[model samples]
Target chain A: MNPISHSPLSIPQQAYSTELQHHLFGRQLLAAEIPFSLDVLETHIEQGYVAKTFGIELDHCIRCGNQDKQLFYTFPCAICRQLCTYCRSCIMMGRVSECTPLYTWTGPAYDFHVPKSVMNWSGTLSEGQQTASDRVKQVILHQEELLVWAVCGAGKTEVLFAGIEAGLLAGKRICIATPRTDVVLELAPRLKKAFPFIEVAALYGGSDDRHKLAPLTVATIHQLFRFKEAFDAMIIDEVDAFPYSMDPSLHYAVQKAKKQTAATIYLTATPSRQMKKQYRSGKLQAVTIPARYHRQPIPVPEMKWCGNWAKQFQQKKIPRPVQAWVNERLQSKTPILLFFPSIAVMETARPLFQNLPAVYAEHPSRKERVQALRDGELQGLLTTTILERGVTIERLEVAVIGAEHEVFTESALVQIAGRVGRSFAYPTGSITFFHYGKSKAMVEAIRHITSMNEEARKRGLLDG
Target chain B: MGFSMANCYICYEKMRKPITWTSLFLRQPKSRICSNCEAKFAWISGETCAICSRELDESFRREQLCLDCLRWENNPEWAGYLTKNVSLFHYNDFLKELIAKYKYRGDYALAEVLAPFMKECLQQLEYDLITVIPLSKDRLQERGFNQAQALLDILQINSTELLTRIHTEKQSKKSRQERINLPQIFRVTSRTAIQGKSVVIVDDIYTTGSTVRHAAKALKLAGAEKIETMTIAR
Candidate 1:
């Protein structure tokens, strides 16, 4: 196991502890960061005293439960043992050895200074959004699980304001978690602005707010591992997104992060078909907003067969249609986002597009470049699907060079297409699928987007 | 989670393994620094100064000793300075950043970066006693560790504090004369015990010969027979 070796932080204890103990009690904290030494805390525990019943549940890691972990790793850990058995999974976050004690406080919870007015936003929700928001608020009050199946660009963040306000008024500590840092970065400022009175901390890797306690936490789902029964409202946005959908440890973290009676609201533009089946079978309470916030229909993707694209790249040349499309976009002075299946392939073809000024290519490792696209400083960006979700570029034309590749799943294709036409100012834009041969996923993605637009039109949610 | 391969601690790049029969029978040398980042490290190899072991600039065509070491070698007052000083790496920006990350940034895991070198130095050297440069309690409290002790700890090597540092103004903030003149910062804690025994002094970095020279003088006056100094980088 690669060890969970966090760089030791040297923050002054007084700076964050007072707020931390107030907001973080009845919750879990990173083992290394608690105010008192573990031995001191352990001594207090051994003398027939548990600090908080919610605290000091010492069997496995609180974050990413070490359920199937094996005792293979041996290390000289002063806190645990000279030889310690660490969990292999979630080791990226930190090394969670069996001896590392994760404590929580079972409360007669501390008193929260809930503000009289939590939300300062005065924006109006559309009728469909209003119904879903009301339902979300009701479900939170009832402490039930619900899924918000809203379309991409449906103002999903705005729709949650009412529900979050209701939670705050009821003196419930809430956490908004997502699978990726991109979403956390995008949502945190918006949330803090909406609920100005509530102290909201954005938690992510290297974030200053990691120890500074606040009643409201906006964090990546990976960060929630250190939280146990921490919140009354645990809203996982982009719940069907990668890692969250693919990794079970994240699910385990979410369960540990929220109270047993806490409401869990899953918000996603593309919930799985299995989830839909579960919703149909009454396993989950569900609501859907078919229309986008812009009141304009999504543009359906058009398929253009660019024959032997793989061969063309092998010959070190961009296919005619792909070059022509880029030329046309550049001629029109429209910024575009071209999605490639892999970084290796995209980088291979990067020199071909270098003729266009301000054109760049990026992958998951190069997230800083995404800002250049967002600032409209670039003519276009050649990207892998890391930008498939949680990115909004106005008037951006999107094209997928290899839409039929196995990497381009139906859900992924939908998200890639959803990147176009996100803003109200640019309510509609083109999404083109350039493929070697059409795969079932490509067809499904096209059908899914068309059906969604059709449904929005039928519901009179589209602008006349 | 569940990394089947080790990752480079400094840059956090995963160390990928390529299959070959050499790895089948004999494992490759384990290194915390991957080959790519490893190339960035300017090691103190090839020709070096005889006294302080700093890398020799070939253009100068100096003898075995560098100018500073030659300055000491030529000086009757500082001649020999007890024995020799050995260093592992050149104090380049790459090493400077690494030490900053390890010592100042409080990344203890980065101690692994010096583990193999520390081990090789420890194994090759013959010493009756192994001691490391110590941090004053105040500095220790601030750093949460002794930078020198961390390198020894990574390899599970035994090291004791032969001398303790006083709370003087930081050596780096001073000039060469000010540093050498600052004070007798080190005191011989157990002079009689080290009598006639060879000792090796370990430190994290060796910028000038001043700190180690002072330590060697203290040890020599305390009746130690021989004193050698080694650091992860110069």
Candidate 2:
């Protein structure tokens, strides 16, 4: 077992992949990876640039604008302190210290297999899906930045199948990148089934498919750092999702992964205000599908005023209204999801709901509980905002314990609301904001959902 | 009811625990691995082999040497050459991966994982000086750091390069019998430091007892009074 083989072992066929080839020749190659491309790489020990060469007191990460936070996780490194102060922000991927060398492949790039047809997803697209799918094809040909501002459960994955097939038919490499691992897991199988002939690999931390090579790839954005100018068309799912929305390095990775002339697509249910402004300014071409494939009205969240729920939690008690709501959901056998503002709040609430034996509370540590919930073992799951996206239950009902908290931003509230009325079997369910007082974010989230439904009605897209 | 934010190194799960007090305070100076990873180690406690310090199964005689050490006793020239050997942990898959991560992947932080255990194990033995088995010049440059030296450098005791291995095929590539039969690769250097001193030789692993035996042979020939072996695992 050669442990240093962590580099994606690109076979000669895979090495010739536009994506893998770009990565092979990309900017950030580790010292160990250089030997694999020894004949191709232009060799030079990359001493992290000479700051004083131009007489600048230079100390800022060119990659992510990371200046400080070094004192937190990586104060004194084990390796040469002068040579290895290690960046803390991106340490989870791999340590990037001053002494780390970057290799550049100067060899000729290889060619990957160009199939005659890549579109095999035979399922008929809804009218909305068809329009969005057509826009994707146009965007790829024009190499424009496109944003697919579709509502949640709008067959967003189906819309991509057409464009992916289009790209594959054109013999252009493509990547479907998302911020969350759950999306990668959710999409990999559906994508593989849609285009069964093409190899599909899903890359994530400790993923079983980490080393596999596929012409069509689905990976979390973090994995994009492994590529450089690789994709001819790049589709970014949930472009405004957390961690990715906050981490500037992930944004940098997305830009670094695609070709300079590559077409870019950003898909989201709730786009940031900046994205809306970008669309208005004609900087990004916009496509919106406000209704799901079922064309049912979205379940707008109703504010349930529970006076002093926080005070109740401190007293080691769930509020009467909250407990009553849980009892109601349990009795009706509605597999519900309760979103607490914090993990601490969720834990304090877990014991209070034990009357419902099948009811479980999950925070970060309780990832295993998610599996049980998916297995239909749990009737209800109490979670933090971690499950707001990337989770789907056929008839799942959702409630926010404290929707007014700062953590429940406008974008997050929209995503949490989007969780409900997702599957076709239900298509409509109660979404409640059990709050002490309604914040501006809560009000804005209601407005956002209402407006999307209004637009769906005006377009005559509703099934009713 | 609550979960920890700090992740376990082995399972990479956030649920196992928060960082322990020992990890917070002493792991840096001692062994810095997470408590969960430290727990995975099967510590060699209780009565151990008089020569190799490997834990004796109930089937083996307590007073007599273990099977590996007993074989050394068969060869008069190798017998009594080393006073004793002390190993801290059993060489399990976890330790194997840990050592591989350090030696192969160049993850230097893992070297600190067993520093404290090694310190405790060594305190029980008596040696005038400490030295580690050295790799050939080419292997040394290739790996950038000696795997054994990375472990010994953590100890407060005196560690010096008193011996060297002449260029030879890697010990891992050789079969058990071939490894036992290979000509001695070690040559003692700076005998002035080793001469008239009881020495403890350190290595990452004590496999087949061939490496420790060969190093001990070279040290005894260099006029060392007594030779002992110390390794992180056996």
In model 1, residue pairs whose N, Cα or C atoms come closer than 3 Å (at least 3 residues apart or on different chains), thus clashing, are A4-A94, A4-A95, A54-A104, A54-A105, A54-A106, A55-A103, A55-A104, A55-A105, A56-A103, A56-A104
For model 2, residues A1-464, the per-residue Cα lDDT tens digits are 57566443322332332443444543344545333443333221122110111100146443333555421122233334332344444444444455554444434543557567655667888878889999998888777889999988898988887777878777777899998887898888898888877788798877987545467889998887766667888999999997789877788788877889999999999899999998989987899998888889899999999888877988888888788887888888888888989877777777777733222233344666666666778887877787787677777888899888999998899898888888888888988898988999999999999999999899889976
Query: For candidate 1 chain B, which ten residues in a row score worst on lDDT?
Result: B1-10
**lDDT string, candidate 1, B1-234, tens digits:** 223476666665677856567665697666666788888888778878777887789664367767877766676756765488888888898899878866764455667667677787778889998888877765664445567777777777877678977645578888887776656788888877889989999888998788888888788778898999998889
Q: Give a tens-digit lDDT track for model 1, residues A229-298.
A: 7789989999888888877778888998899999989998888888878999999999888888878888
Candidate 2 lDDT tens digits, B66-93 = 8777877878867778788778788998
